[model samples]
Target chain A: MKRAFIPLLILGALAVVSAWLALSFGSVNTPWQTVWQVISGNERGLPFDLVLQLRLPRAINAFTTGALLALAGALMQVLLRNPLADPYVLGISGGAAVAALCALLLGIGGLWLNAAAFAGALISMLIVFGLARGAGAWSASRLLLTGVIVASGWGAVIGFLLTVSPDAQLRGMLFWLMGDLGSATQYGVGVVTLVLGLGLSLPLARNLNVMARGELTARALGVPVARLRLGLYVLASLLTAVAVMTAGSIGFIGLVAPHVLRLAVGNDHRILLPGAALFGGSLLLLADTVARTALAPQQLPVGVVTALLGVPVFLYLLSRAERR
Target chain B: MSVQIPIIETRDLNLSIADKAICRNLNLRVNPTERWGLLGVNGVGKTSLLLALAGLKIPQAGSVHLQGRALSELSGRQIAQICGVMFQDSDDAFPVSVLETALIGRHPYLHAWAWESAADEAIARAALQAVNLSDCAHRMTNSLSGGERRRLALAALLAQDPTLMLLDEPVNHLDLHHQIDVLELLTQQVAQHGKAAVMVLHDVNLAMRYCDHVMMLFGYGEVLQGPVQEVLTLDNLSRLYGHPVRSVETPEGCLFYPGKT
Candidate 1:
C-alpha cells in the first residue's frame, strides 16, 4: 500500500506528456514552445485557435473516453471474474453502435446521435441483466453468455443497417463502427462519468479484490455479493455508454489496459483501478495523436490505431507474466 | 453457575436437495467451547448442512439463530461479525498474495473505504504464523501447493476470529501430520478462547478424537446427535455408512475401522 502510489505517479506523468503531445502535434504540427505560449495566453491567432479551440477539447475527450473505457473494463473483469471480460464484451458498444447508425440513417448528427446511443446502451444493459438473472441463481458465466449473445444480435442489426444504407452514409457509418473521435467536441459528460466512476469504485476496491476470487468465496467473506454485483454491472455499463457516446466503439483499450496493468502492478484493485484509468487515458491520447498524423490528413480511425498499438504490447506482457 | 447460551442453534430445521431429504425437524444447539463433528456418507448434504448453519443457505423449514437472534433478521455483515465459514476448495482465479488473502479475514470488520490497518496486518501475520505460512506471506497464491492453499484458507478463517466457525472438509488436502496439527490448533483455539466450531469430516476416528459432540446423518432425513461418547458407537457408525464397523480400544481412545471388505 505504501509504495503503490509510485507507479500511479509515473502513470500520471505519462498522461501529462501524452496530453502535451496531443496539443503540439497534428496534421499541421505546432512546436512545443509555441504550443505552450498559445496555451499560456501569451500568443494569439492560428496557433491559439488550433491549440485551445480545436485540439484541446478533442484531446480532453480522448483522455476521458479512454479512462472511462479502461476503468469500466477493469470493473467488468472483476464483475465477471473472467480475465477475458471487457467493457464491450457485454454488448454495450454494439447497442450504442446500432442506435448511432440508425440515427445517422435518419440524418441525425451531434447531440441527438449521442443521446440515441446512450439510450441504446442502457436498454441493452437492462436486457442482459434481466435475462442473465433468469429463473435460477445469478452466476458470472450466465451473464457473460447472455451478453455475448446479445452483442451478436446487435451486430446483425448493425450489418443490416450498413447494407441498406446509401453510399454517402456508408463511409460515415463505417467510421463510427470503427470508432472515430474527430466529431467529439465536448468533454463534460465523459469527464464527469469517469470521475464519478473512479470515486464510487475506489471505495469498493477491497470488496472487488475478494470478488475477483469467486462469488461463493466473496459471500463467505461477508461481502453482499448480489448487491455488489448489481452495482458493478450498472457502473461498468454506464461508463461504457459514456465512452461509446464520446467516441464510437473504441476497442483494445478497454480489454487490454487493465490486463497489461495487472501484469505490471499485480491485481490489487486499489492500485489497479486508478492505474488503469491513467495508463489507458494516456495510451488512447497517444494513439489518437498517431491516428490523425500518421496518415497525414487521411486519418485512420482511432480504434485502428489503438488495436495496432495495443495487441503487440499486450501479448508481450502476457508472455512475460507467464514466464514468471 | 450462569446458564450458557448456545453460540448457534437450529430449530426444527429441514434440509433437502431436489427430492432427496437431508434431515427432518432437526433441533440442535452448539455451545461455546465445544467442537462438533458432522459425519455422513457421500451425497448426504454435510456441506449443505454446514452452509445452512452458517446462514449461507436457507433451511427448507424452521430457523437458525446466532446467539439468540434469528439468522434472517441479521445483516450479512452482522452475521459475519459472529460467524466465519471455511469452504472446501480454494480458487485463485486471479493473482493475490498470501498476506493479502489472509487480510480478507478483516474485510467484514472494515468500512468501505478503509485500507487494512497495521493492527489488521499484525493479526493476518499471526494467523499465517499459526498455519506455518508466516515465511510465505509475500508469495502469490497461484504458486502455493494444494495443502499450502488449504492451510492458507484456515489461516484466513483464524484471522476472521469469529465466535462460531463453520468449516466444510477443513482437512481435505492435508497430510497426516498437518491434519493433526491443524485439528489440534482448532481444538486449542476452541478451548482457550471459548469459541465454537462445527466441522464436516470424512474420517470418523479423527472426529472421535477431536469433537466433544457428534451429529450423524443417515439417508432419508434421519439424524443422530448427542455427546460423542454416547452417540458415536459401533452400531451407529455401521448404520451411518451402511457398512459394518469394528473398533479396538487403545490407550488414547477407541479407534474404529471397517470390519470386513
Candidate 2:
C-alpha cells in the first residue's frame, strides 16, 4: 500500500498544478493571485466569472471525465485480458455517440441529449453481454470477439447517421464526436462516480489481478469468476457511459493512462486502477489547458488535444519498453 | 471402529458435454491419505472430470460432496478451502511476479476486502522457497521457462495448503528431474499430512509408481477402477488403452511398456 502512494501522490500533485494552470492561464491569461482571489470570492471583475464559472467547471469536468475513462479502461483490460481494450471496447461509446448524433441531427438539446446517450450506452452493453452469454462454454476470446464485432456494427450505423444528417447540425455532431469539453456542465455526477468506482473497486483490485491471468485459474483460486467478470463489465460500461455523457467521446486517455502505469508497475490492479485514474486526469487536464490557450480565442476540442498529446508520448514509451 | 467420512465423494455422478454422456455412475469416495490417478486417452474426458470434481463445473446429473456436504451448496471460496488445483497451463496475458502468483493460493483464505497479511506473505515466500523459486520471486511469470512455470504452479498449490489437491497434468512441460521432484513432494505431503489428491497423468509408468488407486476410462462411459495392483494388470492395461502393453516386474514395483503393434 505504501509503495502505491508515492506515485499516486505525485499524480495528485500534478493534477492540482494542472487545475491551477487551467484556471489561471486560458485565452485571456490572468495571474495566479487573481485566480485565487476569485476563488476565495475576494475579487469582482471579468476575471472572477471567467475563473469561477467558465474555467473551474470546465477543468473539473475534464479531470473527472479523464479519470473515469481511464479507470474504466483499466478494468476493461483486466476483464477482457486484452491490453488493447479501452473504455469503448464493448461499444458503449459507439452507442452513446450514435444516440448523441441522432439527437443533434433532430435539434435536441440539453438534458434530453444526455439521456439519449446513456440509453444508447445501456442498450449497447446489453447487446454485447447477451450475445456473449450464448450456448456452450464461455471463453474470453468469445466475449472479446463479440464486443469487437458489435462495436464494428455500431461504427457502420454511426457512419450512416453521419452521411444523412443535414449540413447545419454536422458541426455539432462532429465536435461532439471529437469530444468538446467546452460545453460540459454539472461536473458533480462524473466526480461522484469516479470516487465511488475507485472506492468500491479498490477492494476487488486484487481479484482483478488474479482474473487477468485466466478465468479457470481465478475460479480454481476461489474467485467467483462469472460474478467478477459481470461486475467489472457493468462498472466499466457505466463509467464510459457517464464520461461520454459528460464530455462526448474523448479518446486516447483511456488506452494510454493504464499502459503508462503498466510500464511502471507490473499490472497489479491494486495500484494500477487508481494510478491510471490520477494520471489520466492529469493528462486530460493538461491537454485541456493547452487546447484552451494554444489558439488564443479559438479553442480546440479537448479530445483532439488529448490524442495529440497522448499518441506521441505513448508511442515513445512503447518504443522504450521492451515488447512483452 | 471409527469410520472416517470421505473428504471427496461423487454420488452416482454423471458427466457429459453437449448432451453426450462421457462417463456415468461414478460412485467414488476419496479419503484422507489416499491418492487417485486418472488415466484416459486424449479427449476421453479426463480434464472435464477434474473440473467437475473440483466443483468448478456443474454435474450433468447427481452431486459432488465435499466433507459430507453438497458442493452446489458451498461457495467457490468455501470449496477452495478444502481443495486446490494446478492446471496444465497458466495464463500469460498479464505479467505478475512469481511471489504474487503464488500468493493467489491464499485467496480462498482471505475475505473479500482483506489484503494478504504479513503471515500470508510469509507463507507464500515459504512456498516459493520450497519450490526453489525463492530467487525468482520477483521475476515476471512470462519470463520463466516451462519447467519453472510448472514449479510456480505447484508453489501456488502449496501455498493454498488444501487437504484435497487436484492436479491436472502436473508434469506437463516438466523435465525428468522436476517431474520426480514434484511427484515426490506430493507423495510426501500425502504420506506425512494425510493429504488427499486426484491427479491426471498420461505416463502409465509414473501413474503406476505414484498412485495407489487408478481409474482407467474406456471410451463411451465404460470405466475400470479399483486398487492399483488389482486393476493395473498388463491385460487390462492393454485393453483399456487399446494397445498391446507389457508389464515387467522389478525391485521398484511393476513397470508397464507398450508392445509393438
Candidate 3:
C-alpha cells in the first residue's frame, strides 16, 4: 500500500502538470508565466480570464470525469467478475447516446438532453440487473451476456437514431457520441461525484477483494454478497452517469486505467481502486490536452485522443507482460 | 462431552434438482469431534447435500439446524461464522494475492467497514503457513499451481476457523503426499479443535482411514448413516456406486476398489 503511494504521488504531480499545460496552450495560447500570474492574482485581462475562468474549470472537470469513469469501470469489472467488463460494457454510453441523440433530433438541447441521457443510462443499468439476475443461480457470465446483448440492442437503437437525424445536427451528436469535454464546464458536480465515489469505494475495496475471488467464496466468507453487489451496481451506475453527464462519453480511460494499474500494482483493490482513479484522471487530462492542441483551430474530441493514446501504450504494456 | 448438541442436524430433509429428487426423508446428525465422509456416485447429489448442509441451498423439505438453531433463522454472517464451506471449483475472473485470498476467511469476524486488524493478519498468515503456502502469499492466485490453489482454498477455510466445515471434494486435485497432508490436517482440526466436518470423498480408502461416521447414498433418495465401521460395507458401496466394488482385508483395514465384471 505504501509503495503504491509513491507512484500515486507522481501521478498527482502529473495531473497538476497536465492542468497547467491544458490552461497554457490551446486555440489561444497563454504562457506558463501568465497562467501563474492569473493563479497568483497578479494579472488580469484575456489571458487571466482564459486561464482561471474557462480552461481551469474545464481541466478540473476533465480530471474528475475521467476519474469517475475509470472508478466506475473498475467497479463494474469487479461486479461482473470479468476483467474485460468496462463502464460502457453494460450499454451505459449506448443508452446515453440514444437518448441524447433522440433529444437532439427532437430539438431538445442543454440540461434537458443531459437529463435524458442520465435517465437512459440508469434505465439501462436497471434493465441489465433485472434481466440478468432472474430465477436461476445467477452467474457472472450470465450477467455479462445479458449486458452484452442489451448493449448490442442499444447500439442498434443508437445507429437508427443517427441515420434518421438531419444532416446539420449530426456533427454535434457524433461529437457527443465520441465524447467531448468542450461542454464540460461544471466542475462542482463532477468533483463531488468523484470524491463521493472514491470515498465510498475505498471502504468497499475489502468487500470487493473478497468478491473478486468468486460469489460463492464471498458468500461463504460472510460478506453480504447480494447487498455488496447491489451497492456496487448502484455505485458503478452513478459514477458512469456522472461521468457521462459531465463530459459526454469519454472512452479508454475507464477500460485501460484499472488494467494498467492492476498490471503494475498487484490486484489488491485497496490500492487498485485509488490507483485507477489517479492514473485515470491523469491519462484523460493528458489526452484532453492533446485533443485541444493536436489540431489547434479544430479541436478533436478527447475520446478520439484517448483511444489513440491509450491503445499503443496498453498494447506495449500487454506485450511486455506477455514477455515476462 | 456427555451433554452435547450435534454441530449439524438435518431432519426429514428432501433435496432435488430441477424436479428430480436426489434424496428424501433424510435425517442426519454430525457431532463435534466426528468427521463424516459422504460416499456416493456422481449425480447422486453428494455436492447438493453438502451445499444444503452449508446453508447455500434450501432443502426441498424439512430444515437444517446449526448448533440447535434453524439455519434459516441465522444471518448469513452468523452461519458463516459457525460454518465454512469449500466449493469444488471456482472460475475466478479477477486476480488477487494468495494472502488476500486467505484473508477472506477473516471476513466473518471483522466488524462492518473495518479493515483486518493485526491479529487477523497473523491468523491468516498461520493458515497459509499450515498449507505450506506462506511463501506464495504475495503471488497472484491465478498464477499458482493447481495443488497450490486447492491448498490455498483449504487455508482460507481454515482461517475462517468455523465450528462446522462442509467441504465438497476437499482433497480433489491433490498429489498423493498433499492428499495425506491435507487429510491429516483436517483430522487434526477435528481432534484438536473439536470442529465437526462432513466431506464428499471419492477415495473410499481415505474415508476408512479418517472418518468417524459414514453416509452412503442408496439412490432414489435413500441413504444410510452410522458409524464408519457399520456403514462402509462392500455391498452398500457396490449398490451406491451401481458397480461391483469389493474390499480386501489389508493391514490398514478394508481397502475398497472396483471389482471384476
Q: How many residue pairs clash in each candidate?
A: 0, 0, 0
Question: For candidate 3, what is the lDDT?
Answer: 0.86
- Chain B of model 3: TM-score? 0.97
Best by lDDT: 1
Q: Any runs in candidate 1 off by more than 4 Å, and if so which?
A: none
DockQ of each: 0.73, 0.72, 0.57
Give candidate 3 regions above 4 Å deviation: A1-4, A28-37, A40-42, A133-137
Comparing candidate 1 with candidate 2, which one achieves the higher lDDT? 1
Residue-level lDDT of model 2, residues B102-139, one tens digit each, is 98989889876677889999999998988789999999
- Give me the runs in candidate 2 sitting further than 4 Å from their true place: A36-46, A136-138
- Candidate 2 TM-score versus the reference: 0.96
Ranking by lDDT: 1, 2, 3
The alpha-carbon root-mean-square deviation between model 1 and the true structure, to one decimal in Å, is: 1.3
> For each model, chain A TM-score?
0.97, 0.96, 0.96
Residue B150 displacement (Å), model 2: 0.8
Per-residue alpha-carbon lDDT of model 3 for B39-61, expressed as tens digits?
Answer: 88888889888888888877889
TM-score of each: 0.98, 0.96, 0.95
Candidate 3 C-alpha lDDT tens digits along A1-324: 455578778777877888888889888889898889899999988888788888888789888988998899899999888776789988877777888888889988877888888888888888888898887556677878888899999999988988988899999999999899887656888899889999999888877888888877887777788788889888998999888877788888998998888787767787788878888888888888888888888899999999988889889988997786
What tier of docking accuracy does candidate 3 attain? Answer: medium
Ranking by TM-score: 1, 2, 3
**DockQ-based CAPRI category assigned to the predicted complex of candidate 2:** medium
Q: Rank the candidates by DockQ, best first.
A: 1, 2, 3
